[model samples]
Target chain A: MAYSDKVLDHYNNPRNVGSFDKSDPRVGTGMVGAPECGDVMKLQVKVNQETGIIEDAKFKTFGCGSAIASSSLATEWLRGKTVDQALEIKNTDIVNELSLPPVKIHCSVLAEDAIKAAITDYKKKQGVLTPEAVAVH
Target chain B: MPPLPRDYYGFFGFDRKLAIDSAALQKRFYELSRQWHPDRFGRKSAEEQEMALEATSILNDGYRTLKDPVKRAEYLLTQDGFPIAEQRGKDVPPELLEEVFELNMMLEEVKSGDESARPQLEQSRQHFLGLREGVDRELLREFQRHDESVEASPTSKQALQEIRGLLNRRRYIENLIRDVERALNPVTPSRPAPG
Candidate 1:
């Protein structure tokens, strides 16, 4: 399917396409693999520990155009936001923002999941378990 | 772990088979894809492009499941009135459980030993190779028996389940063997923790 103009723009010139200091206490990094496509994406967010605001977000993705667009849009949505606000940015929001087709909707969902995984990994490493992370499933 | 579509059967377009030619399956996938992929829709209307993408997606999912023998066996079990999941804590085949534990013990011993891990991994790999060959022989026998109606079958379903259980164990052993091989290879990543 022909991608939307927005999707094509992001694919052509992706933003924040790199990595950050994942080992830092205030930086959450998520590395996700799609076994279906053999694609791996790493996304990271640097948060202000005191104020819990994301100061920077970056990504390194190896996949098709939709995957790149999803990662770029996710990073754009995350910058300068509080952790709680970032958590609220759902897959549907990214999909709608990019106007992704149904076939590409999963790319958005995976990007959203990568964000949550990064945050959770940071919190786990820092040994500060938030209620969100520790709630009984 | 997501729910596979109820129409998964529609992808293969036939009742499942225990033994299939992997090459033939791949060839068929390529043929179906050539006929259905969205790239062919450049000259078609917009709606037609969408239809082509959806069809290709289904074809991809089907080929993925069938191309791997382990997954194909799991799909067969699901067809034969089994829950898709094995009970996590339940004991697998006793022989497999024993084999894994023994190999693991040997690996742990080899890890800090003076001798290189390469020799030990090679040794363990040879052992598992024998086990895989034996399992393959058994699986072939089971497949033949199922195919033959001449034998008065008293326990066909039971036999399939046993064969499925054996296949699951063989795959598990193969996975462990792969891990050991990776560890022995020169491409081993730095240890996760350093002093």
Candidate 2:
């Protein structure tokens, strides 16, 4: 399937394609994989604790171009967004932005999952209770 | 030739079970192939001839699918409502992903002309191969457990679920092994250039 020019662009010159210090308390790291395709993606975000905004985002992915582009685009959109705003970033939004075909929609979904995972990891580090954690109580 | 069973197991006239005698399956396949050879229907009516062709197609496809243990288990999983489709990230254990990510990083380093990581990759390849052997052994036991259980019983369903999880892990490790081997050998790109 032909990738959208946008996907190709991001794939060729993936933005924020690196990682943050995993041990940093302010850094939230998410590592996720798609077993069917054997794709692994690691996305990280550094939050400005006082301002409650994401100051930086990075990603490293080992998979198809669509997956690499999806996470690349995710990091681009993540910076400057508040943690809550970032949570609102949906997989469909990524799909629409990337013009991903039906078969490649899971790539965008993986990116979205990585975002939530990173945020959750950061929250856990902060000892903040997530909604799911609260619901369990 | 009342429309042969759509399912592979049904097409082969085998009971719905995971543990099958390979020798028996091969014998049955040959018998069916001869029965639906199409030449036998040379003087038959047009519809009967068509049915023979259809059965021949199904038999060939079904035999190929059922001949391999992994393929057979995958087919049974889908038949039993465990499609083994894309697993959600939550379904995968985090530590496995972490390991996969690290191995991938090492592979990239090696691909970029650094041979320093070669020894480590070789070690990892052996580790992953060992992991795959363990998964295969467990899968064998699970197949037996599944076949011994009553069809549609809770035990059968549970076994199927466990098989699905095991298959996912196996697939992950298989990919890692393939990647490590490729990195160590430095062949053509692991994936075709993306379009």
Candidate 3:
């Protein structure tokens, strides 16, 4: 199937693809997998404790082009934002941004989930979740 | 949980337990597929062909569900009780829904920003893993007791319901983690993408 231009762009040139230290206090990591498909995804966000801004983001994934594109889009959205803003970023936004098909929506959903997992971890480590955050990370 | 036909275990010709013989299961599936598969009845009458297809589909479904423990548990729970699809009316605990939503959001974040919250992602994995492990253990215990009973009990009923919810929730979280891992760690991204 011919993916939308946005998906092709991200798939062909995925961004912010790497890993980070799991022990870092400033970082929150979410590693997940789809056993049904034998796919794995890892997402990370470096939160600025003082401001709760996501100073940086990264991911390492093992699946298809849609999965790659989704993760790529997630990292691109993560940089230069408060964690709260990052939290607001939705899989629907990524799907719209990438123009992904219905079947590939899970890939987009997956990327969005990783960001939240990472942010949640960061908040959990901070020892207190702000009332505004709901601390679901 | 995946839906399985009644008497699925009987079709597979095995005792109900986590310790299923993989090789036997595969061999039986392939053989059944060869025997009952619609492809073999392509030249037959329409009624015969339809029967062949139905049989093969049932065989495939049963074997697939029995092939994996997580799936098996989920299938058993679903079989024992109500379909989770109908549980939408009830209020699920916030903790359960929260993790599922966040796991999805992180998948989007890490895709664009590499190595941003890698640590946090791992932490989430650990947390979910812990939760899943506990749930899994609980399921095993329930199943064991269920095996010993002459008939189902109220406790088993409740446990299976909870198991169904956990399994469905886990499946969602699992999908997100896979998307991130596949995107960033593709030494080989050559496989077919998910639909």
Error of 2 at A119 (Å): 0.7
DockQ, candidate 2, vs. native dimer: 0.75
Measured against the true two-chain complex, the DockQ scores of the candidates, in the order shown, are: 0.02, 0.75, 0.04
What's model 1's lDDT at A29?
Answer: 84
Poorest lDDT segment (10 consecutive residues) of candidate 1 chain B:
B85-94
Top lDDT prediction, candidate number: 2
lDDT of 2 at B117: 88
Any runs in candidate 3 off by more than 4 Å, and if so which?
A: A131-137, B1-75, B81-141, B148-153, B158-195
Compared with the true structure, all predictions reach lDDT values of 0.71, 0.90, 0.71
Here the TM-score of candidate 3's chain B is 0.61
Query: Which 10 residues in a row give candidate 1 chain A its minimum summed lDDT?
Result: A32-41
Candidate 2 deviates by what RMSD? 4.3
TM-score of 3: 0.54
lDDT of 2 by residue, B76-166 (tens): 9998789888456556788889889989989989999998989999989988999899999999999999989999899999999999999
- lDDT at A105, model 2: 93
